[model samples]
Target: MALFEQIRVRLPRGARADAALAGGVFVLVAFPEGKLLGHGGDPLPSRVVSWLLVIVVCGALLFRRRYPVAVGWFTVVGTGAYYVLSDVDGPLVLVPIVALYAIAAQGRMQAAIAMAAAMVIGVGAATLTTASDVTGTAVFMLTGWLVAVVALGSGRHGRLAYAEEEARLRATEERLRIARELHDVIGHNISMINVQSGAALHRLKKDPAQAEAALSAIKAGSRDTLQELRATLDVLRRVDEDAPRAPTPGLARVDTLVGSANLAGLAVRIERTGAERALPARVDLAAYRIVQESLTNVARHSGAGHVTIRLAYGDRELTVAVEDDGRMTARPARPGGGSGIAGMTERARALGGELAAGPRPEGGFVVRARLPYGITGERWSGAADDQGPAGG
Candidate 1:
């Protein structure tokens, strides 16, 4: 058995498999058909014609996948010719059944049904005029076999279609995830660098020391951005084992965001309530991205001088909120204006959580999110309207 398996494994797939199938079917049908015809008093000339017809029917199977309906009709016609010329029942009928299966597997159910009907009717009609012993039971049994073959092929087609769709969805989700990660990683640092560079230029002439400090902050922010960028890109090159690895950003790195926000001239404060404990990786990352994107929006759009970052750990969930005492501006809407809020909300919801981003009732803008412990929940009806003035 093991040696047989080794030989099977070495056999090429696809067309080669079809060729082997045709050869096997020819051997099974041609040999038995010749003996049956000879035993039934068929002359040598008639037997030779019967063998050639069998060869033609079996050989048509080689192109079953490429031209399933065409091959099916050819085999059906060839089988009918074989029956008309010879008086013996033979296994050549199985070839057209195989062709029917191939047609159904190619998602041609209409053609398969039509061919099956034709064959059944043809056989029934042949039994009336021919001297053969085909009975009603035999015709019914053939119908059952044909139905089973078509059903199996159709089932295989459905399964393959479903799997392909699932693969496409997974690919789309992965792309969106990567895009969100890149945006969060680069947007915050770039905002900080932009502010720091402006500060450095403004102070370059007056206070050289302050300008030097601003330049140093820009350098630090640039370095952090590059490192984070590398880490994010490393995930895409999953084949590289020796790539420089950095810890994935999570709630543990909230302080880094606070520091960057401070460098951008926003006085940032972090407040935590309830019991603090380790969180699932997905929750940790989602919370971190929410905070990071909030700070980015504040720096870019909100003219807020003070921002508060809040984290409240509950019994079953974690709440992350960022509020800023910033002025609201009637900024003209642009393409991709609120992508940050959308991404943050998607991240929260993907982990069975919810997020809300809108203006605080009293004044400034606020972005809040709730992440659950379990990774399953009903979807929230949060929309893009939840995006506030600070939306990036």
Candidate 2:
């Protein structure tokens, strides 16, 4: 079956090829031994009529894809007429087999089955002809061949449907990924801006200097937000020739993020260990967003005095951990749905990684993710793990 599928895949998938193939089948079936069916029949008129019927039956097959059921039934009726009239059996079997296959492939299973049964009965009916030499064994062989052709056509139809479904699934996943990117970029930056502007409003009259600083921070954050928005929206700008794209933020910008968090009243410390190595673009982006979302959660939910962000580079993996000395309320989600952590989890799994986010053993919340560097490599310990790196 696999070998047959490979051959079918390699065949030219075009109307021209199908027409040529049908024409070839017609030649072989209509002109056996340089003469039409019943080559030595006493009645030349009957033989000519039989040959014309075979030609007409095979001719309908050229439009099998467009009108499968119509052509299939036409071929079946024409072949039946020829077999009843012609003295010789000829190669009438090929026409109905091809036609039934086309009908079944077009999702007309009932019609194809009915036609196949009719052809079998037609074979039995032809036995009444004095010139027709169709034996019981010959009828059985033709019937079995017809059944196989229907089965093959059904298989081909199923494969085509499966391929289309897979394409739709891919398109859905792409849309979801784009939505996640938009949410992460906009949510994180806007949260910081909201906190800063609120501070500015609260201290505007009492301390103009502090208010001015907060407003300046909001301005900077908004500019960063616009750049990140442009980067996020680039996925939808593939068709735009004039769309300008910005660099995507990665771990290199973690320090910038820490600075922004500090300005938003969260004291965050960054710790880096292990030799840094280049990461794939997806891995880099995932790592950055995970940390960003984690910190945003901390700023919003965690009432911790200080937070620690750790970046660990290992031989086979890279890990990032964000732990805040905050307490979780009864509410299970952030401002929006619980999609923040869910998105981070999806990103890690997409890269063949795992994420852990929960309350720490001590008294705070921790979010840690471990992303592998290569396809075939040992797993590495997460940043919050106490058992050291994997393979150590």
Candidate 3:
């Protein structure tokens, strides 16, 4: 069985070789039978013609793989003609039967079926007219043809189904990858913006100056964040339409970000060191988010009276530390407690960076991040001087 399966898996050389070999074997076997024509009250010339026809019919099998339908028709016609010419049973009939099976297995079902029906009718007509044992021939021809049709159809259907299932799985995996990227990009910025906006609104009336400042900070953060997000999304979208045009916020926006926090009532002070060379897009976005989220946390969780943002740009790395003087005892419970920190950590790790957030030894919360600046040295040169209003 295993040996047969191996042989079945191999590709055929083509119809010509197949036809020649099969015809040669049938001719060699049927050659001696020419004498039976005169002894059995058979027409000697008709029997000789049938033997030659069998040899000719063998060629039909050769073309079966390349043109199964045409081969099947040739086999049916040759076998039918042989049946009318001779009383002898020869290997000629089996050639077309194999062709019929090939048609059912590899050709379209409608074509296979139509050819199969014709084969059945032709074989049945031949068997009834010439063969002595009509009963056995009738049953074998019909049953074998039907079996071939069913087996071939089933195999083709199974292969098509497996291909479709594989395609579906691949598409599902791609969609999941896109979804994860979108969440990481959009979720982090929107959360920080929401937290900061809430803080700004809460402190608005009591300290109008701080409230206006918070509002302004909210506006600027949202505008830049939205622009940055749109730019990132544009990369993912197809190029059928015009690409979205929105500037991304980089390290240069840190001053405006800190100024907004100052206006929101969190007295923010910023210190920068090193030549502010351009950074990679990813690193720039990461640095911006780290500052935004850290300040948001200070405003929302740290009961700090003041916050400080310290940025150090080195040749190979960029570092940011946000420390606040808020009292831990007076800090309100964070909504969805601590998941935000985990999300921030994930964001940092994605860029081969690190984030440290904890209660400071000096009695407040501190968020620090270290981002490698290796390849991202291009300074983002488009920071606008006019800080936008805070988003609602």
- TM-score ranking from best candidate downward: 1, 2, 3
lDDT of 2 by residue, 56-166 (tens): 887887788778788888988888887667665678768878888878887789998999999898777767655456788988998889889999989998998899998
List, residue by residue over 92-123, the lDDT tens digit for candidate 3: 55666566666665636777677667766665
The top-ranked prediction according to lDDT is 1
Q: Better model by lDDT, 1 or 2?
A: 1
* Model 3 TM-score, all chains together: 0.45
Give the lowest summed-lDDT range of ten residues in model 3. Answer: 383-392
As for candidate 2, its clashing pairs are none
* TM-score for each candidate, following the candidate numbering: 0.88, 0.74, 0.45
Superior candidate under lDDT, 1 versus 3: 1
Model 3 clash tally, residue pairs: 17
Task: Please report, in order, the local distance difference test score of every candidate based on alpha carbons.
Answer: 0.79, 0.75, 0.63
| Model 1 C-alpha lDDT per residue in residues 76-192, reported as the tens digit of each score | 999999888855668889899888888888789999999999999999998887766898899999989999999998999899899999879767766666667667777778878
What TM-score number comes out for model 1?
Answer: 0.88
Model 1 lDDT, residue 243, Cα: 34
Best by TM-score: 1
Instruction: Indicate the residue-level lDDT of 197 in model 3.
Output: 73
